[model samples]
Target: MTEAPHNDPAEQTLRELESRVEALVQFCDRLQEENRLLRQENEQLRSERAVLSERGEQARIKVESMISRLRSMEQAS
Candidate 1:
């Protein structure tokens, strides 16, 4: 036969606390995983930004050189 459920106040409160703790532990684990993923993504973005910035600087230098050559030719003509 199935035993009757406990109606004790202290036991009920303890069970509730246990449930809350379990939920909190799960939530913390999820947050940690999410934080790890975000950090990885941030690092990748930083690397990409650095590469793009370098490329932009190179392009700017090339453009300036072209402009200087054009000015020189104009002045000679």
Candidate 2:
């Protein structure tokens, strides 16, 4: 009967190191995906902010126009 080869200390250490490296690679991949999603969310929020700012400006212009009309009417009366 043939016996299986026994693991030497050096070979065992090498195997452990290889496993750690693979785990690090997976962790890096997960971080990259998370970063990509965050960038997309940030861009969407910026677009929404711009739209809201434009709407606020339009509302301010309308209010100013109404106030001017009221002042003119009061002066005439």
Candidate 3:
């Protein structure tokens, strides 16, 4: 078979640079996906917090009403 062409120094450097650029592109894509997932999780947590706060308020009102009824009974007696 005919001899293969010898690789020159410039050609080798170009190949190495190209490989590094490809790795950087892949890393950027992974980071973007992670950021999107985190944003979604944050929104979900906010919604849950709002629901819990409303439920707490309802419980407080119910307890206060019961106490008022008990106080009236004690005064009547």
Candidate 4:
């Protein structure tokens, strides 16, 4: 049987609506993936920052100790 061509206005409208909804769903999925990756990267960066901060503090303390030793030697001389 030959199928009739779809010429109904309501059917056309529904098809268009379905197309738009599908596009929106795909866009939302992409955004969610991007958000998840960004959060992971942010967490990694924060952890790196904490490690760097600790190293800096430790270096500062070592430098201060050396300065104190130098001052004592100078006073003895």
Candidate 5:
């Protein structure tokens, strides 16, 4: 196919395209940084939640044991 002529309009279009590409690159870089920080925060929160769940499970086991002991004592008395 034949190429289009490079007139004033083509030059203007190229400049606009360059400007848009630069803006998109900058935006993508910022978004990547933010996403990295969010992922780190998410990992940390997950770790904290895991620890809390373990503690809750321990507490539940302890409470159940205590309840069973109380029932046994009451039955004996």
Candidate 6:
């Protein structure tokens, strides 16, 4: 088998490729952690939103009832 030429450019390219792979692995790990945190935050926000929605509905009903009652009183006057 013939031996390939020892090119400096090829060696540099190999080094650059190895570094890129290492960086990619690190980036994947960081993204995974960030995704986990975001999921937890989303769950918390959903719970809070549900509670707020219920409270808003209750407030809306109360206001509607009050408006209805005021209209009847004014009509009676």
Candidate 2, residue 71: CA error in Å? 1.1
Pairs of residues at least 3 apart in sequence or in different chains that clash in candidate 1: none
lDDT of 1 at 77: 100
Give per-residue lDDT, candidate 3, residue 6: 55
Output the better candidate (1/2) by lDDT.
1
Which residue ranges in model 2 land beyond 4 Å of their true spot?
A: 1-6
Query: Candidate 4 — which residues are off by over 4 angstroms?
Result: 1-5
The residue pairs that clash in candidate 5, if any, are none
Give a tens-digit lDDT track for model 5, residues 1-77. Answer: 97667777988799899999999999999999999999999999999999999999999999999999999999999
* Model 2 agreement with the true structure over 1-77: per-residue lDDT tens digits: 96545587777888899999999999999999999999999999999999999999999999999999999999999
Candidate number that wins on TM-score, 1 or 4: 4
- Candidate 1: tens digits of C-alpha lDDT, residues 10-66: 879989999999999999999999999999999999999999999999999999999
lDDT of 6 by residue, 1-75 (tens): 966566778877998999999999999999999999999999999999999999999999999999999999999
Which 10 successive residues of model 1 have the least lDDT summed?
Answer: 2-11
> Candidate 1 regions off by >4 Å?
1-5
Candidate 2, residue 73: CA error in Å?
1.4
Stretches > 4 Å off in candidate 5: 1-7
Position 6, candidate 1: lDDT: 89
Distance from true location, Cα of 66 in model 6, Å:
0.5
The C-alpha stretches of model 6 lying farther than 4 A from their native spots are 1-18
lDDT of 4 by residue, 1-77 (tens): 97646877887888999999999999999999999999999999999999999999999999999999999999999
Error of 6 at 69 (Å): 1.2
The C-alpha RMSD in Å for every predicted model, in order, reads 3.3, 2.9, 3.5, 2.6, 4.8, 3.9
